[model samples]
Target: MKISNQNKTLDLTYPQVMGILNVTPDSFSDGGRFNHIDAALKQARAMIRDGATIIDIGGESTRPGAAQVSEEQEIARVIPIIEAIRLESDVWISIDTSKPQVMKRAVAAGADLINDVRALTVDGALDVAAQAGVPVCIMHMQGQPQDMQDNPQYCDVIDEVADFLNERIAQCIKAGIKRENIVLDPGFGFGKTMAHNFRLINQFNRFLDFKLPVLAGLSRKSMFDHLLSLKVDERLASSLTGALLCAQQGAHILRVHDVKETADMLKIMNTVASATH
Candidate 1:
């Protein structure tokens, strides 16, 4: 499978890693690390060098209890970095925002995909994504970041997520977004409990029922913290384990922080699978 826009094309026949670049001051992990333009460029280069085919740049922290950033502030935080990277690299750039204005400007600045945690539910988001003509990743989040995890309840998490994504896919199509231009994320940590995350990953293939690409983002997430009592920085081992597990379960893209490590794991898994075949 592949995700493509006018300026970029990402091959997903084999699992790919999307390096996370948060240009926010308070993301749960790696916040305030690359808020500067040069710093963001440097990190982008490192991830590309580390085998990241996609660089997902987020201007707002969507961590639970995270404050919302205005569209102007978000565009200011991310556009310059997008332009700078495009001047030097053609790597797939994913604008990670739900605001329509931010989405419009980021794509104009050279973003190739829209990765919205809200699944385009924000007013004007669907129209902007449909008009931008880039691949859109619709993630499932039950509530706003401020209260999503306060008490996320689901009679059946996988089924509920699948139902939500399916509905979003239908909406996108109705809005004129091409089927090939849509991707699905189950929103591993957005509104899920630790057990909910595990079940989602295990039954991940069910999401492919839409026949769209599925993105799994479990890198250094709170799920590991809750399950293993490990802090964010100390979750690399657990994170890589989750990546490998997701890939084995047919995840098309793995949004991650440890790019090189996850890339290495995918290499080994691919090699062994090829040998077996």
Candidate 2:
């Protein structure tokens, strides 16, 4: 499968890595590391060189209990980076925001995809995404970022997430967003408990029922902290393990931090699978 925006296309027949570029100062991991335009662009270049097909850029920190950022502030944080990257490379750029204005500006600056954690529920978001004519990744979050992880509850985690994503897909179609321009992210850590996250990864393929590309963004999440008591910098092994599990389950895109390591791991896995075939 492939998702395209204008002249750019990302083939999903094999899983693709989306390097995380958090341009915020408070993201749970790697925050403030790339807030400068040059730093951000440098990271983008490195990720691309390391085999990343997409760069998921975020201006706001969506970590639980995070402070909210205004639309102007968000645009200021991300637009320049987007413009700079566009000037150099044609790598797929994904704007990681829910604000319609930010979405509009990012696309204008050359973003190829919209990766909204709110699933375009924000007013004007649906319309903006539909009009942008780019691939949209609608993620399932149980609540707003400020309080999503306070105490997330689900009768059945897998079913509830699937139901939410299904509804969002229908909404996107109703809003005039074409089916081929949509991607689904089950949202591994948005509001999930440790068990909920593990269960979601194990049953990740359940989302295939919708027949849309599935994006798994479990890189260096707190779930690893809970599962193995590892610190943020120490979660590489666990993160790669989670990524491999999701890839084996047919994840089309893996939003990750360790681009080179994940790319190498996927290469080995693909090689072994090809040999077996």
Candidate 3:
């Protein structure tokens, strides 16, 4: 499978690494690290060199109870980086936002995909994404970021997530977004308990029922903290293991922080699988 925009196409026959570029000062992990244009560009270049095919840029911190930034502030934070990156490279750029104005500005600047955790539920978001003509990754979050993790309840985690994503897919199609331009994410830490997250990973392949690309974004999440009491910086091994599990289950995109390590792990896994075949 492949996802394309005006600038490039990403082949998903093999899993692809999407390097995270949080251009915010308060993201739970790696915040305040790349908010500067120079620093952000440097990280983007390094991720690309390290084998990332996509650079996901987020201006706002969506961590639980995170403070919100205005549309102007968000555009200011992300647009220059997008423009600067476009000047030097054609790597796929995904704008991680739910605001319609930000989505419009990011795409106009050079973003190739809209990776909204809100699934385009924000007013005007659906229309902006449909009009942008880029691939859209809709994630399932039980509630708004501020309180999503407060008391997330699900009768059945997998089924509920699947149902939510299915409904979003229908809404996107109804909004004129083509079926092929959609991707699905189970949303690892968005509002899930540790058990809910583990269950999703174990049954990750269930999302393939739609036959669309699935994106796994469990890199350095709090789930590791819950499972092994590991700090964010100390979760590399756990993160890589989660990534491999998702990849093995047919995830098309691995959204992560450790680009080089994840890329190397996937290379090794692919090499071994090919040898057996």
Better of 2 and 3 by lDDT: 3
lDDT value, candidate 1, whole model: 0.94
Candidate 3: where are CA atoms >4 Å away?
A: none
lDDT of 1 by residue, 120-191 (tens): 999999999999999999999989999999889999999899889889999999998999989999999888
Question: Residue 26 deviation, candidate 1, in Å?
Answer: 0.3
lDDT of 3 by residue, 51-81 (tens): 9999999999999999999999999999999
Query: TM-score of the candidate numbered 3?
Result: 0.99
The alpha-carbon lDDT assigned to residue 38 of candidate 1 equals 90
Q: Please list the Cα RMSD from the true structure of every candidate, rounded to 1 decimal place.
A: 0.9, 0.8, 0.8
Error of 3 at 253 (Å): 0.2
List the candidate 1 regions with Cα displacement exceeding 4 Å. none
- Against the reference, the lDDT scores of all candidates come to 0.94, 0.94, 0.96
TM-score of each: 0.98, 0.99, 0.99
